[model samples]
Target: NALTPPNFIKSIIEEDLRSGKVKEVVTRFPPEPNGYMHIGHVRAIFIDFALADEFGGRTNLRFDDTNPAKEDVEYVNSIKEDIKWLGFQWDNQYYASDYFDEMYNRAVLLINKGLAYVDDQSADEIRENRGTLTEPGKNSPYRDRSVEENLDLFTRMKNGEFKNGERVLRAKIDMASPNINLRDPVIYRISHTTHHNTGDKWCIYPMYTFAHPLEDAIEGVTHSLCSLEFEDQRPFYDWVVRECEMEAQPRQYEFGRLNVSTMVTSKRKLRKLVEENLVDGWDDPRMPTVSGMRRRGYTPEAIKSFIYETGISRSQGLIDIQTLEHFVREDLKLKAPRTMAVLRPLKVVITNYPEGESELLPAENNTENEEMGIRQIPFSREIYIEQDDFMEEPPSKYFRLFPGNEVRLKHAYFIKCHDFIKDENGEVVEIHCTYDPATKSGSDFNARKVKGTIHWVDASSAVPAEFRLYEPLLGEDEESEELAADETNDVSADEVDDFLKKVNKDSMEVVQGFVEPQLKDAQPQDKFQFFRHGYFNVDPKLSEPGKPVFGRIVSMKSSFKL
Candidate 1:
């Protein structure tokens, strides 16, 4: 458990502790709880909880459930489960809706101080008037409304008098602030939708930026940690806390967000994949979601190690997906037991061996760890090897099961291909070979060696299982193409429809396979290293009591050095 040393956040905490500027470091992970958590969220969770742990402080898990229109209990529960599975716990759990009463009264206080006004513009109108980076926003005609009228309108809006988007209360900040977020941002809006937490009791909900800082102050959170995208909103965050007269003040800090090449974590894109029947579900093995990775058999330790290596910084850089796979291989190398599986089963008949004769062979459970002990595998005359292991006419240096060639059958005996069967299509149906008993594995009579060793399973004892191979979830060219589309300022439904074409049709490849008899009772989430194939996990959704579906976690190769 070698932790990342002395990064910027760590340095800040150390200095704060030394200077006595902060007696107790308190942090919180406030997620909007609208969708499933993705890999980018890993950095925030680790930093928030890890910082508190290093400083002898506390961290709370808070759900910023301000907009109930898109939030649900399923997402809320899943978020909590993902955080727990990531090896952390919350000191206290709170929701933004839990303080609706206080938030409502605080809005009244802003109105009483003549620092706020109610605007009757529609959502589009507000956005239009909010202006752009170069232009100053125009004020609403109702901006000069008296405090008494503003308070009345806000209270009535809370009583469900206003329709969903009729009117919204705005903080009376400068309309021409250079920082656009400070220009009279919306503080409260009327939403008729029932909330997962608050139910139908309240119709007026506080905006995220407005409620976020208030929630932090109420919880006495000393540090409000979030991604760099919220940097522009920091000013408004401070304004809400200060104007509402909250006693406890928390400072907000930003960090670079993690991104992976060839994978898009955008909620819009992910939801498209789910809604259009492109992916199975949120826990689809190809997805970057925590549950998806967990279902695919990615160990928490591997994810944490990868995150540590990535480290915290102010600038975000794209991480190649291979780096993540390398960590998985690194963590599972010494843990997962080695076994043989033939994904595309090709029958191999050992003509020289006695027919119907099966015997048990000993194989190391894990070559890197002796304490894991050995597992017995059944070997017989008729066995199954990978279809790709044999070639009728292999190129030069090819030593596998071609005609008139001798090769080793991993942990078994040397087999020389003598004949083969073919179907009407002229495809190799089965391979016929003769075994050399003297060259049995672990035998001291080693006079020669073959160039290649392939894995196999006994035909009689091979358990039928499904192997799911995955490519990049995003199409090879979709990353740049989609970014280009964004730059064109196209938000039409037709533009969104083009996403289906951009999805990687080859992302998931399912094939029937045969595993060793030892894997007969392999349960869901069980992991094994298939020799020459890669590490795989028993898929929970598709796996049954006797038959299991294995999801390829990562192939057993890497270009990553560390």
Candidate 2:
């Protein structure tokens, strides 16, 4: 009664089951393990696994590792880890190489049936003869060889007698079909390359089009869902399935791929970026790759929520990257605890307060999570405020510190600035203020209202640390262009290289900053809100004992106003 729930191929599967033509459903996520899976693949994997689960069917994780020259065991492991991280487990892990022997025998069957031939033409020559979209392709001169001759040559190819790229086995499909995939597609090619799994046993390897359907049929997949780009290839895929004489005859369905703004997603292009050192690695936080997002603190739940909000439309669309960040903020707001740290320090001396005296101030761990409880912050005579908090000559709307102005030192005392000292470069170095002892925080005497309540770090008891401010990898205009041509992916492969170029010239400006002494014992991955500045988390890769590096996740607000 589930009726495959209405998508193209699924609807067919549902109808078949209802009509007693089939009993169960089966689907597969077949990724070519040449590189780390990107955010786009996340959607495909979820759809493949979820659809089968919904219909009481099974899903297989199949590696289309036909191109051994590019595939690696590293990618295979990463693929598995990513799937498990997303909370999906495959019924079985299958590899295209597992059917190498069967695929070879099937090729022999086609040759014996006089439906395929061995072509000695080079790759370039084959492309030249394939013709354009407007014209029909020409058949190979060797296309008319006898079945015995083709079979003998193919057998020799299997025996590794031919060098790499010397010859290829092509199906005897139509050259006049408008769909170029049907133009006698290449079924087997000489690679002479050692595979990650089957090793050098395969000098002649099966092509993706030839290997994928075999993988599905062998695994008993009833619906083979793929992207819209493969729509034209479905006919050829079906032809090969029929020629191979599959009993189940798995159907192919197409859907639009996930495309996001500000990033390029092609594996080849991403690899180029990595090779060219345009990025740090595949998992660079700037990359649109799933690994990159993970390192940047994105949760799988947030990613899934973004996908759901984007909706599943037949028409291809590009979603703004900001939409993703929005969901991340929404999720973390309720989950992450809040703390305070100063990025740029400016000294403030309380002239009226007794020297060397300190008090423990109570601060909320997270206003959103009261159960997290309160933490004690040490406050003393000499403290450090944000450098931007005080100006000798402030603008009319600037509510912070200036001569004769009163502001509340957050969670402590109200102070009135009287004087300031500056360095030779004219930068405000320090400020002198008078604190109202009667106006102690959390007391009935703290009745006086102030225009601003600024965060402060006790200078004598503060911890010295590194604060990293991250900006978008590229500017709005440049990122827009990169997103527009994702299919042509000329951007970063390793992203670190591209990041070096696209870095906001002032992306990371080092400053002498201070944090409350309580953070001195904080370890990596510990997150905090820098009071009025922004939300941040410790940099796992950069932080060290006694020298912590904090990465700014997002500011308290979007862009700063003048």
Candidate 3:
């Protein structure tokens, strides 16, 4: 159980302890309970939990559930489950809603201190008062209210005495600062909505920027870990904690968020895709969500490995999605059992084999884990090969089936195509091949050199299955431009809007196929390599008894034909 060494965050924590920045470190992962956790969240989770683990500190799982309008118990539970699945335990479970009463009292304290005020102006009017980056903002007309009047108004605002968004409690910070967040940010606003946790206890709620630092200070968190988007808001975060007069003000650190190419991680956009039926659900195997990756058969070890290999860098960059797929492929290659499945089946008749006779062929279950043992597959006269396995007219480099070409039926015997039959459509209906009786696979077949080996399943022994092939969910050009925008270098607003319009339309394709008999009883999440086919995982949500649904994980090679 050797632990790996320091990323920038861990390095900082180590140095902090050496300098006695407080005896031990404490970190917190505060995710808003609005949507499922995605890979981007995993990066923060790993850094938060892993850094704590390295320094023998503690990590808290806290839900920044201030936005009750979108937050739900469903999302909260999903976040907890995903973190546990990633193999991290929370030192304590807390919610921003848990401190609603305390946060309200703090707001009252700010009003009594004349450091905050109740503004009756509309949200738009407030925006107008807050001038451009190059100009100073004018103060609110009510900015000079007596402390007693402000406290009374704020108390009424909390008591459900005002319409939603009619009034907001604003921090009385400088309006002329270059940082917009510091221009008297909204600490709390009126919202007549029921909270998932508190349930109709209050009508007003605290905004994220105000609640987050208060949460860190209350929990005694030593390190407030967040993404780079929060970099500009760092000063406001520090101000809130300081204004609260906390003894130990938690330090905030920012790092670039994780981005994967060809994948959209925005919750709003992902929700749009789900609501528009662009995908089956939030857990669609092609989605970048943790649940989606789990359904797609990606192992926890593979995800952890990808996180480690990507490393923690302050410079933001878009990671090639293929890199993540490659780790999954490499990890599964040494673990998953091998089987045979024929998609787009083509009939092949072993003309020389006795009619009504079948043979048991030995096949390796897993090449990397021999102790997994081998399984026996039924081989018969009539078999099904991939439709693409044969070409009626052969190319010079083609090593597979043609009228006179010889190839090995994997794990069985070498067969030479002698003839074929065609239907009225001129499509090859069946291929006739003669087996080399002396070259049966278990005997001298291993020594007989062949240009190609193709996978086949016994026609009568094959089990019906559904194969799901996934492609990129965004158009090539659009995805590239979107990636550029996310890097925050530069892009026109028109380009941004048009790129979002090209969201993936044909992201999923389902087809009927046949799998080996061993797969008839396969359970959910069972992973396997379909011999010459790609790696697949049994989809738990769509799979049924005797009717397995498999999602293609990744191909054996980039040049894979089927």
Worst 10 residues of 2 by lDDT: 480-489
Q: Candidates' TM-scores?
A: 0.94, 0.89, 0.94
Which window of 10 residues has the lowest lDDT sum in candidate 3?
A: 480-489
Q: Which candidate should be chosen as best, given lDDT against the real structure?
A: 1
Segments of candidate 2 deviating more than 4 angstroms: 1-22, 438-440, 444-448, 477-512
- Cα-based lDDT for every prediction: 0.85, 0.78, 0.84
| Superposed Cα deviation of residue 386, candidate 1 (Å) | 1.1
Tens-digit lDDT track for model 1 on 1-562? 3244457877777788889878899999987777788888888898898888877789999988887877777888999999999998899998888998888889899999999999999989998999888999999999999988998898899888879889999999998999988889888888898888888999888888788888999999988888777788888888888989999888888888888777666666677788877889888988888888898899989998888888888778778888888899999999898898899999999998898788888888888899999877888899999888899999887778899999998888899999999999999989999999898787875798788888999999899999999887775445432221111122346656776677787789999989998787998989999998899999989999999898899887942111
lDDT of 3 at 547: 85
TM-score, prediction 1: 0.94
Candidate 2's TM-score reads 0.89
Residues 1-562 of candidate 2: C-alpha lDDT, one tens digit per residue: 4312345555666687899766787889998888888878877887788678877888889988777877787888989988887777899888888988888888888888888999999989988888879999999999999998998899899899999889999999888889888888888999888888898787898888887777788778888887766777788789878888877678888777787765656676567667766566887666677877766667777787776666544546777777887877787776677766777888899998898788898987788878888888888889988888888888889989999999988778899999999899988898999999877777866456888888888888889988877665555544332232111223444553554466444444445587878787777767676777666777667778877777776676565443
Worst 10 residues of 1 by lDDT: 481-490
RMSD of 1: 3.3
